[model samples]
Target: MLSFNSVSSRVLQTLNSTFNFTATRHACKITSIHAITSMKTQPNQVNHSVELGNRRKCLLDRPGLFGIKRGMITWFNDNGRQFPATVIEIDSVEVIKHKTEQEFGYTSVMVGAVDKLKNVNNLKLFEQAGVSPKHKLGEFRVRSETGLVPVGAELKADMFAVGQMVDIKGITKGKGFAGVMKRHGFKGLAATHGVSKAHRKQGATGGNQDPGRVLPGKKMAGRMGGRSSTEMNLEVLHADGDAGILVVKGCIPGPNKAYVKITDSVKLYGKSIESIERD
Candidate 1:
């Protein structure tokens, strides 16, 4: 006697054999086999439920190696919240030269300013890099040995899109010689204590004979800003190719008209709010 349980098991096994169930780390694909079946079963097909496997992140999901180009400072306002941002005119970042690991010890692309250089800080460096003279120059490494953009290819603001994060590198505005309070954000001396005109002076920066005189890097009055700085994970507010502008949210290093470099944020790229927790 064919019991109902046994009959059902046989039917399931037959159906399983008919349909090819291929499972992978990314997805489950079920390919149906062409087989004649009863009209009732055909119309009322039993749907097989699959608890999908975890999908692996693909190469496309990962942000690729990026390039650097000079940008200018601009302002962006969102809902009355005005923000000073650095806007790069990335309409065209001509690839001046390509360096190889075999010949140059490392792979990199030397890029020059958009137009003829009005002021060049390092003419010898540009000459060695085999690029035309420009106001400024930068190098970005390539991921693969053959990852090279054509020498004359023009890179636009489109390289970085709105909502994407980037690291803005530039020279911070020079404040000249400044007090410790302003330079290192040191709180001024006690308002009512024995402190006199030394209110803004960095307190007691001396060490014992073991360490010798005031520490080499004592936080005393010194030059502030005017140094290379990198603002990381700055979100892109907008990007315009025609205007050659890229608006980033929040402030970046450098004063108005100062040259800046924009590149993919190392820690923030290809990350979502839920996946990323950063201060």
Candidate 2:
């Protein structure tokens, strides 16, 4: 017969071995299950990332929309910093036609905004697109055929997200026949020493007689503004799809009710959504 102490010791050893074996088996099962689940999810995560990247690339490559200038307002960012923002109204923007690379040597889309009487030249195109006549017509070039928008698809201001950078092209306010001092920011001649009524005139355009007559591109008093201008890297502050309003940071070139073309920033083409979120 074994002593009580020895018998108890033997039983405890057996129980400990059994518990260890059970725990080890359960831990292994859990680890294997976790690994299998991770394996199943890994491909999905990769595909999701690829999809986001493609969408971002497509957004960058796609054509832009047309809008009307709606004046400016003060805006505050998340950091409580105030900025002057320009409001743009997008209405009745639709794809008018598509230019194919095979036929046009490059890919682009013709878009129009603001309904108007159908012009004879665009009657056929508008009828085919099933859209009303547009008053403001603009063409935007795309990187590839995939960026072409479907004809007659209406676009809204919501296409631009807050925090996205954009470039606005428009006709600036006209200042008819401005002097050099106002147009080109030229400093007038001294008002004290010996300056007379000619103080406001631009002093001596070209050299004495080297190249003779004023240079072809000489800067002098002339018409100011009213020309096509582009304001680059303007940040989108807000976008309302239903209302078709886009608020952008800083001033845009144009007067109220003037049509403007809004496009993604060419300078920030390399930036992606991830980088924007990081910033």
Candidate 3:
């Protein structure tokens, strides 16, 4: 007569061989023959869990990379939750210069990205920095000189990690001579209350003979967008240093292929609340 423990082990091994369990299902439970047979199996292997590394937190500001907006994509989390992300392509970024507080009254690093083969007017600038001519240049201010990277150092997308928050600055799409309703979200005049040809007007300008002259900062129509704007506290969804791609959650300013400045979030600094794995 076989012992109860031996019979149960035989039954479990037979079940494991017959059924096709997914890695996730097997990891969540005990489906492996070794895991069921051996008492010395590592707990982590039996129940696989992805732990986020806290490597993004920093004490001071650091230089950021310049990237081109490649467009948007959808991402799925480990739990199958969906999220919208904007993909930014990071070119070959190199440190071009360093601005010390003694020389420039502030500590900063100048980085250039997107190599330019020809028509580089400032060849001496690249020569002095010992770097290739780049199409785009950006300056990043740091709290101190310690944050300055050596000149000619190449920066990559891995400077930022998944779950790290960042701030992106870009020029918004230009809308020439927009109306107040479109530009400032004005309610405008009612369509049917005997308001002829002025349905979309800004309604009124100012008071009558009292502190008038159409107040300097009135919400009237003018050239809309096409100005520098910053989106803050956007979480990083993915970063591929080898592929030179950086993806962030939600939409950013400007149209596709437009250059944007990326930096650590001023509000959150370099602290990351959580991390996500690339699918």
Q: Could you say which candidate leads in lDDT? A: 3
The alpha-carbon deviation from the true structure for residue 133 of candidate 1, after best TM-score superposition, in angstroms, is 4.9
- Give the distance in Å from residue 66's predicted Cα in candidate 3 to where it truly belongs: 0.4
- When summed lDDT is taken over every stretch of 10 residues in candidate 1, the lowest stretch is 51-60
For model 3, how does the per-residue alpha-carbon lDDT over 153-261 read when each residue is reduced to its tens digit?
Answer: 9999999989989999999999899999999999999989799999999876988888666878888999999999999999998899989999999999999999999
C-alpha-based local distance difference test score of model 2: 0.82
**lDDT computed for candidate 1:** 0.62
Error in Å for residue 153 of model 1: 0.8
Q: In candidate 2, what are the lDDT values of residues 1-279, reduced to their tens digit?
A: 899978866765676676432234323222344344343344345644543544354335788889999899999877999979998999999999998856865667999999986344657778998999888887887766778899989999999888999999999999899999999999989888878889898899877779767889888999999999999999998999899999999999989999999999978863444555677
For model 1, how many clashes?
1
Taken over the whole model, the C-alpha lDDT of each candidate is 0.62, 0.82, 0.83
Kindly indicate the candidate among 1 and 2 with the higher TM-score: 2
Candidate 3 or 1, higher lDDT = 3
State in Å the error of residue 190, model 1: 1.6
Q: Please give the clash total of every predicted structure, in order.
A: 1, 0, 0
**Which candidate has the highest TM-score of all?**
3
User: How well does each candidate superpose onto the true structure, as a TM-score?
Assistant: 0.62, 0.73, 0.74
Please identify model 3 stretches exceeding 4 Å from their true place. 1-60, 270-279
Error of model 1, residue 278, in angstroms:
25
Score residue 184 of candidate 1 by CA lDDT: 89
